[model samples]
Target: MGRKEDQDKVQSVLELLKKQAPLTLKQEKFCNKACVERFLKAKGDSVKKAAKQLRNCLSWRDSIGTDNLIADEFSAELAEGIAYVAGHDDELRPVMIFRIKQDYQKNNSQKLFTRLLVFTLEVAIQTMAKNVDQFVLLLDASFFRSASAFMNMLLSTLKIISDYYPGRVHKAFIIDPPSMFSYLWKGMKPFIEYSQLVLVVSSLDFEESFEFNDYTSYPRVTSLRFDPSSIPSTKLGPCSSSRFSFTVSHSCDSVKPWYLSLTDTSASKVGPTNSSQISLGPVISPLNARSQSFASPIDRGLRRNDNFIRKGFFPSTPMPQKTQSLDPSMIHHPRTPKPSFLQSPALFFRKDYQVSRVEKSRDSFQSFLKFYRRPYDEMIYRSKMKPPLGGLISIVSPQLKRRHMSISQRF
Candidate 1:
């Protein structure tokens, strides 16, 4: 249909839904399938089940501290939440809890409320018996939200650590776009100040910013990209050190590149309670789902604090070649010997030639070109031959010379 027809269709749908609304005593709010969808989060036959689930979520809102069954802690009634969906404790549920609401004419939307997330996380983390050193926090690409929420939660959490435990907690963030906004990283400049380390992960292909363009000395942060294309200069203007890193995780079919940037500056600004960022990338389809090696957001947050979200380098085995065939084991189980890219052929091969080095050494082209200019140079260099000392004319002995001369004369 044309523009006018499309508008008419939209208006008609709104009117139809409005007619079916279950209005409240207060005139401001109207309810319908959309509101019910938001409340129960139902898809398909799960509407009845979702209604039950929403009741559970609403009733529980007590202390969000270090308790394994934090939800249970709030109310000691019946049980079973995450496992009902992702059998064997899929962490996606709680991680979804941290989600910035997505806005539609019916949706709420994306703003990263870090403490908002951590409030739930503190319960997850503290409830476990694992060593603090063993935990690594992993974040998935939350679509249409700013990292400000994530960063604020991270820095404030770190500030808490710095005040009490000092270097006890370490955090890393992964940014995947079309799914997320880029500017969400604003106030995150100060994380390196509180924690011993920080890592910035991106779904773009170029090198990502670990730190913004300012500091170039502080250690403990790694910036990485997730694809093959060069990341924009504005995203990663400078680094805290030359030791900053890059990590690419897309499959052959994925056009999107991964990116990362590092900074050593400290974050001090009180960003916001709701940081709904609107920018987003193309959605990750189930077909290319395996192309990404992202963890179950909940498990990465609460259950498994493993290698994928470490203080060191991101793994180099490379995200599995098959994008959508991700192994469930990989998501939930932490790798014991985390792989390194310093030994990867891709990383090594690329490092051998970067734009800056190629441009800077243009003057040495003549010396290099000389090898190709003279065909004889190949034989000389191939044999590792050296010129005679002092430009002296060196030749074969007279006995051998006579044999060579006879052979040459005949030819």
Candidate 2:
């Protein structure tokens, strides 16, 4: 009934609401905090109810229109899991970051790409409602799975956003190929023909890209600078060399800087005994150092402990060492051919030696290899050669289908 009692009660309610609407590994915390305060102030008498409403407002629990294609099995499960994850946490709801590595097409259709992306973006956007801001995306060149059936679903969706919302995306991009965005034409070039431009960010010597116009014209890119402060000096540990982004940084610099060069001694950027050779030479220009880093999407949140809590959201996984990549081709691939059985996951799993199918198949390995090499002279193979039906066909060839009859030898 008293004024002081009312003030304390309201403050407590506001605090609880702030704690509940966690900022998680995202960028929306400041807006969330301000929004919560406003909500509480408005509903003075029943501020607890107001706080609850505010929390729900900030969450993905609210109604969002979904493209009917995604309305089926996966979307329902996704919605529930996101809400479930949000339910367990402190203040922030979990954020989902989706990036497109390739301009996706189904069989060979843009319509297919659009529909898939719509469905994907629908759920991904919904997933971002309560928890995430676009601040921290854990980008690995090998963009692996995050959750159930994620790779297929995620790639499909990211392609859509890359085509549509280039300016909005703030996640750190790694060197995943076939990914088309404002500049890169890994796959989505058809959609952006003559309309957009892609900049070559790396410092390496690249064959000239197929031409497209850069859209520095509108909302216009008045200036662009690579922010090096956000990039981590070391990706793995003390003695490993980074392949992608550092080379891009090297590309921007003149006078073979040791850090940019493959042969720098100050760096553990390479590997094993050779890592010591990878080092940044003398800093040449201040601009190069600035260009050397990717300016990370700024975090606007308060600190908690060893980890900082932006708003109320905690980092779901570890914060990534933001990397600036050269081009997709630069991400490391071993030049040597790996044994088929050792190379792929599908093969590794199905390769039970006891299986009669596998034993029969092995007999024909030489037959398949026969065509791969032309009379066994040249070792050069097209690095980009994909197998028939769209993947490494050498690994999964029709010869696999042919039954090699066993000829039991009689002495």
Candidate 3:
């Protein structure tokens, strides 16, 4: 359709939507031109259908209090990290990642989960660029084992998005989905558009394709250096017991060592002492310790000579001997010798177990391939049985054959 025709249709839909009921300020704000266009596109440019669906969506939103959903209300659900809005796709569409593994239907009610879903959608819509009305959905199913139990929740969520938030999903990807996820996918297929559904091996593929950093992963710690100067001197007090003792070492020799001190609140002498300077014991260098005798024959054999040690060939060091004897309370009976690695069950059966696992996976994948290939084969056979219609069948037959060939080659 021409630009003028599209504008007239949008205006007609907007008028019909406004006439259906007196729109509140929230409903009016929501029924913007962009939203009207989305509904129109979703309903195949039919003004009546778009207006009716848009009106029903507005009514549903009001019933659910979509605009008034506070993030704090779903704090537990948000904290679980099951679903949240983050980043954007290559098309500047906002991305919403759903961690399927974190969801537990038994712990949370269906109503609560629905509320969380609506809230997440609202947030994603709000974060979209001015011209972008849709959002990219990523379902991280790497550790998803409860596909059967989660199917209902997944279907309800997809239904809500399809029914109320039409034309709002740019794409949907299932990342590292397990074999069991096929069942969930079958149930969800009806709600999702065929072109929008994508199965990727990993989230890295999605992030790399979009050229965006994944905020879902834990951030790397740049530095772990702690400044001892941050500790207050007034809080430092004499520790009567040594059980809570801890040592803090500095890189420079000029800096004095600090010890963890616990003050006795009930004690009369609660003043600070020279506890920070108190040494736990003499520290032994690895070189000197390597020269000492070892408790085990394995350690003795692994010990290196001075020439080899100086060259950094063998870095193994023996345990240092204590200057003091162990108290009766601190002593324990000697431990029994550990069995050799060759005699262990883990080492004995690991190879056979791994082979069996590989065989099982191969069998399952082959079965999956057969299951996936049957439909295309049937389609091609059916297409062949049908008589040619204006040579349309000829064009479509090659496309189907090529598609099947490509799918086979991909696997």
Cα error of candidate 3 at position 283, Å: 33
Candidates in order, TM-scores: namely: 0.23, 0.20, 0.49
Candidate 2: lDDT of 166? 27
Model 1, span 247-283: residue lDDT tens: 4444436564544444222221112213232112212
Which residue pairs show collisions in model 3?
none
Q: Is candidate 1 or candidate 3 better by lDDT?
A: 3
lDDT score, candidate 1: 0.32
Clashes of 3: 0
User: How does each model score on lDDT?
Assistant: 0.32, 0.36, 0.58
lDDT of 3 by residue, 201-319 (tens): 34332232332223223223212335567656554334444223344554335456566644333242222324442232211223223323543344333232334232345767988
Model 2: how far residue 274 lies from native, Å: 50
Least well predicted 10-residue stretch by lDDT in candidate 2: 374-383
Candidate 2 lDDT over 23-122, as tens digits, reads 4433244234434444454465466776665555445212222213433333332333211111111223222223323232223364544543344333
Q: Which candidate model has the greater TM-score, 1 or 2?
A: 1
lDDT (Cα) of model 3: 0.58
* Count of steric clashes across candidates, in order: 47, 36, 0
